[model samples]
Target: MFPLFLWTALLGSAALEGPESRLLCTSPDLSISYSFCGGISHMLSLGVKSCLTKDNTKDDLYLFFVPKRDIIELSVAIQVWFKAVQVAKFTEPLCRGFDDEYSFCGVLKGETINITVPFSYRKFIFPQGQYTVLFEGISGRSNDLIFCVNATVILK
Candidate 1:
């Protein structure tokens, strides 16, 4: 559960828009739900079935989803991989401070978790290549995996 103060701060922002496309994961952990928003219009979607459409607008990407209701003790992690090479890793603490134009202020709405990735963020810059984003919800007590999302994105 998030503190009341944090929740209030997050909800102060405008509600997130939807995504233009959905990137499907190979075998998503069903305990959690995910959403993605991007482009200038901030189109939103429940999930990405494949690669996102090519866009050079350098718009920010928003990730929002709900976690399991029963799990109050867990930490989240975001990882970026390019051609199987890990390029970036974000822990919960790091994400909390990554609120510049390059990232979102980690926010919680009800059971939903929200995060943003600004185009100016170094990790979002692809060298005219493809990449994968992994979002994980991990158990805090036993250090076990709770939920995971693997989405592919291409930069052109």
Candidate 2:
């Protein structure tokens, strides 16, 4: 039989799957509007949870945006920091494997861009704790900042 605390944690994890956990972007610039809908899932259990699991976690990031200008190119950076120390970082072209309709590699003014990136966490092992996840989008041409979403995630 599971302990009371373990049962409670399991119940709490179930509650997280129902819409309690969501990505909230803070202090977004006025030039663009952004939003995301997705969650992290344990690779072994395949359960969608609010927190991230150690090596072998998967992140389904469904992000959308409305650009005010013609965006020639874009890049994304996802970093995990624990206690102000950089633990892991992933950076790559924003629309590498996505289809053209969901790619933001080249966008036009007033066009809406929707992208879904499935991130595989197979490199680093995060200890059980809370960490900050920073998701950033930037202009690939001029290296200008586009937007950033800073949110917290637990690693269990």
Q: Highest lDDT among the candidates is held by which one?
A: 2
Q: Can you give the lDDT of residue 61 in candidate 2?
A: 57
**TM-scores of all predicted structures:** 0.41, 0.53
Q: Against the true structure, what is every candidate's RMSD?
A: 14.9, 14.2
Best by TM-score: 2
Query: Cα miss at 89, model 2 (Å)?
Result: 4.1
Q: In candidate 2, which residue pairs clash? A: none
For model 2, state the Cα shift of residue 92 in Å.
2.5
In candidate 2, which residue ranges exceed 4 Å CA deviation? 1-59, 95-102, 122-124
The candidate 2 region of ten consecutive residues with least summed lDDT is: 25-34
1-156 per-residue lDDT for model 1 (tens digits): 556754553343113323323433322211222333222223222433232333323335555555433243556788776664568888672222333232222333235555555543334334755665666666555555545544555554
Q: Give me the displacement of residue 82 in model 1, in angstroms.
A: 1.3
Q: Write the per-residue lDDT of candidate 2 for residues 1-156, one digit (tens) a residue.
A: 556765675355345444434443222210111223223221001113233334335656555566654566667788766665668789877543335344565677667666665766567555756676666666766776566554565543
